[model samples]
Target: MTRILCIGEAMVELSAQGDLWRAGIAGDTLNTAWYLRRLLGPSHHVGYLTRVGRGDFSRRAVDFMAAEGIDTSHVTTDPTREIGLYAITLTEGERSFTYWRDTSAARGLADGPDRLQSALVGCDIAYLSGITLAILPDAGRAALLDALRGRDVVFDPNLRPRLWPDAGRMRAAITEAAGLAALVLPSFDDEAAHFGDADPKATIARYRAAGAGQVVVKNGGGPVAYGGPEGSGVVDDLPRDRPVDSTAAGDSFNAAYLAARLEGGTCADAIRAGHALSRRVIAHPGALVRAAV
Candidate 1:
């Protein structure tokens, strides 16, 4: 089985209801891991790598992963800190987050190089995001990059510029990370806004110049552009249909695309898989729609 390691944070998500909130597990990498495991079914082994506290919430998160068929063996226990928490509100089907994660235990995921190296033992693919890079301290980030040196890394510059100290630092880090990645998936909208790229072609060119071997640029309502040696495009034409929630759209797309491509499907098939899964996710609420999986 192909073993994939999703490295990042998973937080307790509270979605606003009429007077109360619904609690669940959600995060960029975690969402991808969940959808990846679901799509792959029994063929691939998916593991989440992060640190969590000994609190009940942390325990619940771990149990959630196990229930979702994800491996929790690399989840480290940090006695002093608990998992992060976030609240979400949907405004016209778009979601906004209020994070209470300053002391999130996952910030220490790369605390020890040796431990990270050990955990990578059986991993065939390593996946992470720009948010993962933002959460870590310099030392932790350095440790993570070191451990990822020779791995088949898949990265998404899920850009949230506000999280970084500055745009320059974020670019430097992202460029370095892209260089280490075998595949770099970036949203064209975010790329244009953050990097001043004029088009998806520019986004592809930028990442390739930064040393990424494969690049896929997703455009919300435009043609999805991808390039390695050749180029291809796919546009999402499915009806928006008054989305209940647009959360984790990119996350789900990433999962389906990766899962299909890993299973030897063609790029066109992978893109369609991504588009179909993303459409399904947006029609529901929250970052994850676990039921009917």
Candidate 2:
């Protein structure tokens, strides 16, 4: 059995809906881990590596992950910090999020990568997001990158500009992350904003130069481009017919692609699986839609 470790924050999310609200847990890596568990079932083990507060919300999140068959053994509980919270506002099928996550316990998880590194040794694949690196202090980031040296790592540059102090630091961190990743999954808009890439091919070239064996550039509502040992090219004519909400499109796509690749699907087949899953994800209201696993 193969294990996939997802390292990042998991925050409580509240979404407004017709004078009422719905609550769930959501974060980039967490969302991917959840969807991966749903897609792979018991055959592939999924683990979430992050710290949470010793609070009710945190407890609920742990229970939820357990129910979803995600391994929570690496999830640490911190007494001092409180779990982070975010609110989602949906209007006409478009969603925007406001976060209050400055004190998230995940910030501290990065500080102690030595303990995590030992636990991660048995994992077949490790997945992380740019937001995971952005929340860490300089020392924590260094420790994390060092810990991931020889693993089949998947990097998603789920870039949130507001998380970084400046653009220069963001670019530097992303560049470093790209070099460490065996597979790089980046959104076209994020790559362009941070690295000044003009198109998907340019973005793939940028990551390939950084030593990534595989590069997948996710362009919203447009064709997705990919490059790997099997060769590189674009899979065109994939415009979302009616993209309901672009919330977890990229996250779900990453999960589906990785899952398919792990199942021995070709890069093109993996991208098609990614497109199919993302199309279903966006048709719902929240980040983790309550659908059949």
Candidate 3:
């Protein structure tokens, strides 16, 4: 079986519900892992790599991952630190977050990376995001990137500037990570806001120059620009439904796109799959919605 390793944290999500809250496990990479497992079914093995603590939230997080059919064999066990937590606040179909993740166990994943290295031994593809780099300690980040040297990487620079020490550091890290990736996914608004790219095409050119072989630029409610060694063009006929919550739009899109690509679909087909899933995801709440969503 082809094993795809998703490297990052899986936090305890607390989503608002008027006078109450809905609890779940969610994170950028975790959302992708969940959707990929669902889309790929039994043909591929989807593994999630993270470190969690010995608390109840951690235990529930593990059980939640298992329930989603994600491989947890390589997940690390850290006793000192507990799982991170984040709460969601929705407003007119968009979402905002309030995080309390100082002691997140996943920050220690690459502190002593023997197990992290061992887990990648037979992996076919590895996926991670900018958030993963921003959250790690310097040594851990360096170790993680060094270990990813020769794999086929799929990276998303889900830029959250506040997560990094500074813009320059985040830029340097994202540039290096993009160079390591076989395919790079960047959202247009985020790129424009961070890199001052004039448009989606500029975003593509930027990553291509950074050494990524293929680049995809996602424009919210607009055409998606794709450029790769095979060929490139715009996919504009994507779904345009009004989103109920835009929490995991990009993450879900990434999963569907990768699932289609892995199964030998064309870029256009992958984009369609991505857009379709993303549309469904936003019509619901939270990062990982129901299968019907």
Candidate 2 Cα outliers beyond 4 Å, as residue runs = none
lDDT per residue (tens digit) for residues 23-107 in model 3? 9899999999999999896879999999999999999999999988999987878979999999999889889999988789999
TM-score of 3: 0.98
Please, what is the whole-model Cα lDDT of each candidate in the order they appear? Answer: 0.89, 0.87, 0.90
Supply candidate 3's per-residue lDDT for 192.
98
Q: How many clashes show up in model 2?
A: 0
> Arrange candidates by TM-score, highest first: which order?
3, 2, 1
Give the alpha carbon lDDT tens digit for every residue of 96-181 in model 2. Answer: 88999898888887767668777687899989999999988899888988888888899998888899999889888888888889
Model 2 lDDT on a 0 to 1 scale: 0.87
| Order of the predicted models by lDDT, top scorer first | 3, 1, 2
Q: Show the colliding residue pairs in model 3.
A: none
Residue 21 error, candidate 1, Å: 0.5
Q: What's each prediction's TM-score?
A: 0.96, 0.97, 0.98
Backbone clash tally for model 3?
A: 0
Better of 2 and 3 by TM-score: 3
